[model samples]
Target: MSLMDYTDQWLSVVQPQISQGSSWLADLRQGAVEQFATQGLPHARLENWKYTDVKALAKREFVLPKNAATQADALVAETSLALDGIRLVFVNGLFSAAHSQLDALPKGANVLPLADNANVAKTLLGQVAAANFSGFTALNLAAWQDGVVIDLAANTVVEMPIYLQFVSTEHTDACLIQPRILIKAGVYAQATVVEHFAGAEEAANFTNVVTEVDLADGAQITHYKLQQESVHQYHIASLHVQQQRDSRFTSHNICLGGKLARQDIQVELNAEGAEVNLNGLYLGNGRQHLDNHTLVNHNAPHTNSNEDYKGILNDRSRGVFNGRVVVHKNAQKIEAHQSNGNLLLSDKAEIDTKPELEIYADDVKCSHGSTTGQLDENALFALRSRGLDEAMARGLLTLAFANEVIDRIEIPAVHDRIELAVAGRLPEKFNLKGLV
Candidate 1:
């Protein structure tokens, strides 16, 4: 069936649910639906989505999950990250109060579920709008059910990180879920947020997530996203951020599992002295496909941005990295650097990496580099010549290559978790307990 036909059928089933919001939100949903209808699912023809073809997503007949509350308990137990923090759990894209813990937040910190606070939700929803909304983003805005809104008061610092956990529990049939998140950090405030996605190993699910972050002057935020869904699942997520004067934003993205996964990150430095740092790691095994696309816009003078992304591909898996940095005509004195590195564990594995720099200002310092190659034979042989076996030596070298990005993570718990996750995907004979 054509995408238009499938969208028409799906909208018919979800129109009623979309009509429950206030007039402004209703209008927003309507406009988003129209936009999606006009553009349809993104394909290779689109420059941004050239590497990841989402047309395959339209082939499946996915339905809304039924009574996600019933599976919330087991799913939560199975997908715990064991990180200490305030937890906000979502079951199939809907906020679950029973599974969340928000009582211990600081006095100035506010964590509210959008479903319960529609009036306040409308004010913050889609505030940091996407510069060029993709078809999937439009569809998410139209069909989103529930999400979390995090607000920090001026000058207030949140000591503990905030964890947003999204769990899908539809294993019997194909399911579609849209999860939305909005974060506003007040001036001089500092906080950390972790967005995690996980689901049953055998479930055939499609998860589309959109996250918007707004940082006030002098505010600082450290954000981490970990995607570990079922190998049979399809995942597409977009993160858009706006930074004000002297504000700082840092992101660490880890993509580990999914049949086809794509992540898009866009940051706009709208005021002078704003800074951004982005680090990402992705691991692909079997025939899985993983793509990471990032854009940093230097709109103001004296802004700084850094990006580094690494990928490890095994078997026939494919990986892609596209990093674009743009410095406006008037945005002089800007410093931008981007790098993408890939390791191919199998001869059949493939990688496509592009690092772009568009600097209109004369006083800007910008550079980008990308490298794709197999494991270094000399290094492997050196390790094997010592006490290590071939498989152990290869695994150690791969982990060392990935540790460059992992070691930059500020949170110890998160860093340890990622190390274990990466170790699990390595060769069986490799022991990563003491290495990482």
Candidate 2:
């Protein structure tokens, strides 16, 4: 199928099935659909999508397949972390309340499905994550049926982190699943959120998602994303964040699986004293392709941002990293730093890394760098001389290289999970399972 064919099918079959909400929402959805159909998918011709192409995604036939919610419940039960927090589950883009745990919530907070909370949804929907960010984002804005809406009251503190589980089943083949996530933090509020995306090994699901976050003055939010989807799946997601005065926002993105995966993140510091940090790790092998793109805008004085992304590619896999930091005019006293490091384990493995810095202010400090190469042979040999075999030594060296980002995770369970996944990506002979 071609791009037009898939878009026609979505508009004719899928759009009519989802219940039309209020008049304003209906208008927004209508406009977004028109925008997506006209513009189509992002291609290599576009500078932002030059390194990563989505022609295949545009050619695939998109159908809304019926999924068995029971499988998703079982998947969440087996995969979710054992944390003391509220869990929101989604099965093939539909909300699954049976498996969700929302017994307790802070007073005056709105934590529910986005469609269910019309009052809060109307006030902020499409306000932060504008539709023109990308084609997939516009499509998600049009077809997002259900999503999580988190609205915190002033000075509120969520003791436990929130868990969001999105699972795809074998029945999700050739499906078009679009989910939206909207988070609003009140003044001085604090919260942590973890988002996990995965699918059945047999399913070749297509997931297009958008997450919008708005932080009020002095609010803090830490977001952790773990993407371990099926190797046959195609995943595209974008995160848009807006920070106010003295607000803080941090992100940890771990990408481990997907046939063609791309992630786009943009953060805007709109007020003085705002701060942001972005950390990411991606591992690929067996012909997988992973792409990560980030942008930080220092729109106010005294703002700060730090970004670090690492990639490990083996076999014939490929990786791409493009990070840019912009210090706007009059944004004096701003400081921004960005770095991308990659390790290629095979001769055929390829990595394209570009770090860019745009500074219009004279009194600002900004720096960006990118480095890509093979594992340190000297370090490997040093480990070998300490009585460790070649395979074990190689595994140790690679793990240590990736651990620079993993060690920054404060949550013990998340750190251990990432460590285990990193070790498992190594060759079979390099057995460093429990050592991590």
The residue-by-residue lDDT of candidate 1 on 198-285, one tens digit each, is 8777767889889999999999999999998888889999999999999999999999988999999999999999999999999999
- Cα lDDT tens digits for candidate 2, 1-436: 4445556655664576344688888888888988888867786878888888887877777776564676566677766666676888888877888878887788856688775765567877888887988888888888787789999988989877888888877763577778789999999999988888887877788888899999999999999888988888899999999999999999999999889999999999999999999999999999889999998999999999999999999999999999989999999999998999998988999999889899999998888888886678888888888999998998888888789888988788888877887898877778897676
Candidate 1, lDDT over the whole model: 0.85
How many steric overlaps are in each model, in order?
Answer: 0, 0
Error of 1 at 386 (Å): 2.5
In candidate 2 the C-alpha lDDT for residue 308 amounts to: 91
